[model samples]
Target chain A: SQQGEEDPQALSIQEGENATMNCSYKTSINNLQWYRQNSGRGLVHLILIRSNEREKHSGRLRVTLDTSKKSSSLLITASRAADTASYFCATVWNNDMRFGAGTRLTVKP
Target chain B: GAGVSQSPSNKVTEKGKDVELRCDPISGHTALYWYRQRLGQGLEFLIYFQGNSAPDKSGLPSDRFSAERTGESVSTLTIQRTQQEDSAVYLCASSLTSGSFSYEQYFGPGTRLTVT
Candidate 1:
């Protein structure tokens, strides 16, 4: 079963704009991770934010975690056409992991 | 240094036929996971294997779905009496260990299964 739901099921933006996606989950988590998947392809790990860490950044991707609200947000800065894909948020507790439906992002070049 | 790999990238079989999908985890990786993804849907966890421990098969949708792992090297997911609802992209991943730390999972291209 899925653990949470992602907000803004889909988004469309022009190149060079920023895209933000949110995830809300239930139960406590050891960490939260973001993944990107192109159409008909496997998932690519983007960033992981530990429960103790409120924010993390890698390249143009920034992830923020809020344990109190059981929610997290992923931000893609200076979005490119290549950034167009489905982004998922997965919550991990112990050895079990759960992923939400994800947000489909489209960047018009 | 090779990443996770799965064989028979695509499979098409009739209903009631059994099919087996294979996954070879990255060398020395002790954690292997299987997930099913339907079109435009999120991944559905199927099973997990960590080292020599018993696998977690809680996510399996039915009794007909079973999997086996040889030591920590290779794993196969078998669906007995396959149904059309079982058609989906079966993905395999492996992490360095089963620890709940910062370990990230590496995934294969996935096996696309079609039950006609």
Candidate 2:
């Protein structure tokens, strides 16, 4: 069973715009981490937010977590063509990590 | 500093045949994990190894699927009597340590396994 499900399976945006992807999970989690994967490559760690944290920022990325809602959102500010890839949200619970289906983002320059 | 590395970027084997995949984690990382991703699907946890302690094999799909780690370094995943349904991209990841917080995982390029 999948613990996390991401919204908007795919999104297309223009360069310089902000792209937002949301994820929701079924159970409580210790933390949530976001990862990006380019075509035919390994996944790159983006950011991690603990259950106690409501928001976090790293470079152009902003992540928000709502424990009560069992949801999280990742925002990429000033998106670029280089940001075109698949983004995934994974949850850590009881020493186990599970990934969501992911959102495919395309940035048009 | 070398990142996690996996051998045989792609593999193809006939049904009922066996296959082996390998992973070499970062020099000093202590935690390693295996995951499987099917076409257009999310990653599924397969197994985890933390140091010399017993590995967490709860996520393995079947008895035919087994993994071994040597001295907290190289690890190999073996699939016996493979089936077509076992085809997928197998990914290996390693982290400095294991816990729910503060540890970041580095991933390998992954092995695309095709069981015909």
Candidate 3:
């Protein structure tokens, strides 16, 4: 079974606009990581936020995690057409990890 | 250096036939994972192999599915008596270690399997 569930099954935005996606999980997690998939294939690791940390940033990506709420959000700033892809949240517990359904984002140039 | 690799970028098989998907994880990595994603759906965890410990097969949907890995090198996922509902993209990933949940996984270009 999937642990996390991403909201806003789809989103559309213009270039340079910021895009935000939220994910909610069911149980406790050791860490939460976000990934981006292009053409529904390989997934590229984006940012990882541990349960101890609340927020993290990598380049243009910002991630925030709230263990109490069992939720996390990924914010991409100054989005570009290249940023258009399916974003997923994976919650890891112990040695196991489960991914969400993913939010399909489209950045119009 | 090369990343995780999976063979047969795409495969179409007839129902009731058997198909095998292969994965070659990055060298020195001690953790391997397999997942299945149906069209327009979330990825479903299949199984994982962490170093020498026994593989975790709890996520496998049925007994028709099985996976094997030798040490930390290569892995294969085999599905017997394939069904149409089994069509999905199979993804493989590897991490430096599964002992830590903080390690990011490196993914391979998934193999798309279509059972007709």
Q: Score the docking of each candidate (DockQ).
A: 0.74, 0.65, 0.80
Taking all chains together, the TM-score of candidate 1 against the true structure is: 0.97
- Writing each residue's lDDT as its tens digit, candidate 1 over A1-109 gives 8886798899999999999999999898999889899985678899989999999999999999999999999999999999999998988888777789989999999
User: Per-residue CA lDDT of candidate 2, range B49-84, in tens?
Assistant: 988989999889999999999988999999999999
- lDDT for position B74 in model 1: 96
* TM-score of each prediction: 0.97, 0.94, 0.97
**Tens digit of per-residue lDDT, candidate 2, span A1-109:** 4678898899999999999999999999999999998884689999999999999999999999999999999999999999999999988886667788899999999
What stretches of model 1 exceed 4 Å from their correct place? none
Kindly report which residue pairs in candidate 3 clash with one another: none
Better of 1 and 2 by DockQ: 1
TM-score for candidate 3, residues paired by index? 0.97
Roughly what TM-score does model 2 have, to 2 decimal places? 0.94
Which lDDT value does model 3 have at A85? 94
- In the predicted model 2, the residue pairs found to clash are none
For residue A21, what is the lDDT in candidate 3? 99
Per-prediction fnat: 0.60, 0.62, 0.79
Determine the iRMS, in angstroms, of model 2: 1.7
RMSD of 1: 1.1
lDDT of 3 by residue, A59-97 (tens): 999999988888999999999999999999999888888
